[model samples]
Target chain A: MSGAGEGPGHGLGGRPTTGARTRSIAEAAWAAAGRDGERNGHGRTRLQWLMARFGRGTVIGIPYIWLLLFFLLPFLIVLKISFAEFRIGLPPYTPLLEWIEGGYLQIKLAFGNFLFLLDDPLYVVAYLNSLKVALVSTLIALLIGYPMAYAIARASPTWRAVYLLLVILPFWTSFLIRVYAWIGILKNNGLINNALISLGLIDSPLPLLNTEVSLYIGIVYSYLPFMVLPLYATLEKMDIALIEAAADLGCRPFKAFLTVTLPLSMPGIVAGSMLVFIPAVGEFVIPDLLGGAGTLMIGKVLWSEFFNNRDWPVASAVAIAMLIFLVIPIVVFQYYQHKHAERAEES
Target chain B: MTDTLVQGTHSASSRPEGSRPGAVLRRAEARPIIEIQDVVKTFGDFVAVDQVSLTIREGELFALLGGSGCGKTTLLRMLAGFERPTAGRILIGGQDMTQVPPYDRPVNMMFQSYALFPHMSVEANVAFGLRQDSLPKAEIRDRVRQMLDLVQLGPFAKRKPHHLSGGQRQRVALARSLAKHPKVLLLDEPLAALDKKLREQTQLELVGIQERVGTTFVVVTHDQEEAMTMADRVAIMDSGRIIQVDTPHALYEYPNTRYVAEFFGTVNMFQGQLIEDEPDHILIRSDALANPVYVGHGISARGGATVWVALRPEKLAISRVQPDSPHNWDQGIVEDIVYLGGISTYHIRLDSGALARVTTQNLERMAEPDITWDDRVFVSWRHDNTVVVTG
Candidate 1:
């Protein structure tokens, strides 16, 4: 009541003071009603109101709980296996906990698997090779996808949708089938050599299959859509006036593209690179099918350790090491994303 | 260098009393910087700018004013070298520029969207054009600083365009476009994105900057008020053609056609027949008025010709008592009164069944209007206020 008397209408006249008094009286009645309701144990209405107010929380909880159950739970299980010793048993690994003598529980932990990974040179070489292959493949995809994305982005509106659909048209087929088709084209007497020979340009078949080049071709072809889609999205949304402004500033077309268009599409480039690099690092199918026996990647090493060598503990440890190797690039990607988000918020 | 045909020649009757006459006087003697010789642009079959010829003098703030789809923007684009004319040629600084690309042309354009590079900071955006010329690093830095200071955005030099306000971003765009000191600067609806109050302020600031720099500026705008406020000379465009070219005062006071009068501002129009045409004076007989309207000046038209009489709303005086004048006064009943704080506009319905708008300043601090709705009133104008147009 005192606060109401000291409000904006304090010095005016009788009419405003009387209006403020009536408002204060009404506010007091509302407070008394709330207290009365709480004391009478009428909690059902209050609970219903709380639920109505916080319904968005319930909607957000669905995906949160899903990630906990599906992703985090499986990861923890693998982590537990990575700590146990290997043995010929039902689960093919030693138990983390057991009941020893006198009905006392004993816990056993092993660091031998992690130690073995560091001791062996094959693991070191495999990790480096996987990094090299993923980096090379990501670069190849970017070089090929950027122009395609730019062309599609600059196309007419009706043609833009058509070109985008054509880029993703390869995805409707099975991944395994697509990889298999690459084998036929990259064989010794495959399409390239056959065409050259028929055109009288080649006298002998070329060794096109089972090489690093073939592996790169396969990886790039498989992940080209992932690279092109993000690039197109950013390029299409860019204002065409920025290019004009650059030209009006006395920049030639190519220089304008380098200074204006390229820098503006960097977010898409980073996003596409991350999307292709992370999966290509652990890619097993393309390396096994096209890389033949020479190419060594961590995914193949992990596969052989789990199946051929039957070292489940060592395989789990290798998986954990591979995850650690990926964390560095993911962190860099996160930093760029955070910077972009801040810039967006400021605007 | 010497184009006698493009020189500005006018009489006192054309240029009104209140506009910036000094700008007109200064621009009338300056040499023409840009000559657009019957340029035509067509997008497939639809013509955007059709055989439009214009001349912009050096150190003049010229505006191409028109409504949307009226070829004003297309003409500006052609001047900026972004759009090549389908016919004819353009000359900038006495050089043929029709074949020159936008990059090679000595002109810069400030886009309506302010299209500042989002990836660069304000300092870098202003330095971008200088860098393209491969100027010394120290010179580029100094010029960028100088441009920023000119726009009063020196404190925000390090900020990116996204972090700046709309007005700040607008200033940065202006600075970047002017950093190169191009022979001509083109602006496309520069203040359309700003709010009304800020727009008015920026308009004056832009004029001040133009005067300080003394660079030839060609601004394209659909807003008549902005053109009138900022431009030294304005060209009205419509349907891919130039309608009339004159100073703001001349364009308003002595419009050559009905379209120019209606497009520039609000006016009450009367369809009348020229009863008498003389060297000193003329008479118009309008069915919307009870008596024939007498004009103080004669026009180049025959007697008994169909003409339009355009009377501005502000020029008419409204009162309850009948005025002494019989020819220019009309009796009407006030149908509506729009109170606009400083002035009141009365919508009157005349006995001839025509609607007329009369605006008057509120001279007294009265609680209620003395001339309310449904009150019979007389609205009259001076003989010199009549603008007779044949088209």
Candidate 2:
């Protein structure tokens, strides 16, 4: 690995034309090597320095490329396939990247399915329902969960731990289990129905199951913890002095809460709602299990298009459409977070 | 004229004739705006405020000064109706306000953290209390504007807490607290968050504002300098009891306890016994030095009572040679010297292990450095300069 094995006169460090100059160059290189610390630099070479320059690429660049490949690439593929026409018994058809004689293909494409979606009312309704359901569920969850979060925040330290545990415990168990458990209370012959009938509250089972009410309950149940955690984080960090300060400023308890506590808790509410709403928009299972076959949702529609109708192109198109619906809000939320971080820095 | 008005309305035929409105009004006329009458607040077994009592004048800027956990904040909270006294009552404007909740109390508190509402506009935060009282919309707006203007925050009304600077946010909190027009304003470490220079300026401004508003102010602070500069009367607390309550100058000149003398500021304390009592002056023989110290006050207490005499650093004269003025003479070797600008402090180690710190103002550039580290020096204070502590 060394120029030493070869003549000292014949290497990159040497003046190749003359032996004495080469020897002098070798001696200088050796002195530089000797100046190194206890960790030996004797065997170091130009190749290691060159490799170190590109070393960070292996760490940061690989994950970046990998995410682009597995995550971004799949999304783009869905977008590409979405523009293709769907046919019965055919996988989603696309003209993207057809092989050429040079063993290469077309690299870029356009949005025909997006045009088809815009022209159709059902697709538009799906987008609207998703937005409607997600927003409604998030609002309901926040309204119910803030008090619980506040109670948790103000509770004794031991009780706070217990309450927070109860809030998050549902999340630790399988999401499916919680959804199914809701069905037991919601079904016609299930807990609520049976209890009501047995107690002579109703002669017949009410049409409570397989309704938007049931779907709403399921959505709220699934996302309530999301709202509570963020709200708790904000509420717990709140200075009790702030409440006292407000009260001292002539506010009654209710007014103090309205002015100080509620306003300060808005960031938590916004953050929590964003988290709950975004995922709930794409929710397939909860609505499916509780919504019955008549449920008209974007996720359900996409699921049916893929499995029931065997329209792969439309399924991919639905996935892309879902993404298009999501992108703006995500960007907005991330921008808010970044701004908050900056404000935190300034303060 | 005020006394006749009260007596005319009272029932003179009541059981004890003189104990009626006549006496009550007479007492009320001279009484302070606030009185903590044997107010004791105990949390479990820890007495946060132990039977403390003090009077605050109608427009006095009073300070409760102490170190952390010294019950200053607790006392302030009790006064503000945030904490209930365990065994005694607090009177505000001659009304017993012990059971009153913080929201209902006439007093308003500016919290230590400057707790401005994060979500509201600065104007909205200020308007909150007025709105709570169900004031008319126009009146609420007017008062909010007035408060903001008072705090010089009228232009920044729409700015949120995060958008404003620390000082601006602090002003918003100040505005909000003042908007209520409280009977008395309680400030808990009001300028603690500001930088040193800003704190000093704000302290002066706070005193001016309190005076202008004509509201009594009770400020709780751990910083001795803040308490001294801001308070008309300072109550020094230690271990949940008020050690001494007096004007800053009085407390410095006539400390009632060794703890109060040391806690208020830096002092060179000598453990001593009373040697003689005089009408104009008293002499105290100290174990730390060869001579006795003469203080301004006369002490008549007996021979064996352990006592202390305190000397402020600036009052003590330091010289490398023997003192030419003989009556107030003492000696020590300079253990350490710190050359602070405008004044240099000499920490002189005595025959006793205690180090007596003496500061001399660097008044002249022509004067040679009198004492340096390890230089044996004579330090003395005038008879009138020394303060006595008999605790």
Docking class of 2: medium
lDDT of 2 at A295: 65
Badly placed stretches (over 4 Å) of model 1 are: A1-54, B1-26, B275-281, B302-305, B323-326, B366-369
The residue-by-residue lDDT of candidate 1 on B1-391, one tens digit each, is 0121112112222334226677566777788899999999999999999999988899888999999999999888888888899999999998999989999889999999999999999999999999999999999999999999888888899998988988889999999999999899999999999999988877877877776788898999999999998887889999999999998888998899899999998899999999989999999999999888999888989998999999999999888788887588898899999989898889999999999999888888866677898999989999999899999
| Pairs with backbone N, CA or C atoms under 3 Å apart (clashes), candidate 1 | none
TM-score of each: 0.88, 0.79
DockQ of each: 0.65, 0.49
Best model per DockQ: 1
Per residue, candidate 2 scores C-alpha lDDT tens digits across B1-391 of 1233223223222223122345334434654989889989999999899889888877767889999999999999888877889989899999999998887888888888877776678888888778778899999999988887677777899887878877777778777888888888888898899999877767766765665677788899999998877776788999899988877777777787889889878898888888777777777788787677776666756655677878889898887778666456678788888889898988988866678888888899888885678888888878888777777
Tens digits of lDDT, candidate 2, A44-154: 543233234443455466678789989998988777777666654445465666787878775545466667677888888988898999999999999999999999999
Which candidate has the top score in lDDT?
A: 1
- For model 1, the DockQ equals 0.65
In model 2, how large is the Cα lDDT of residue A116?
69
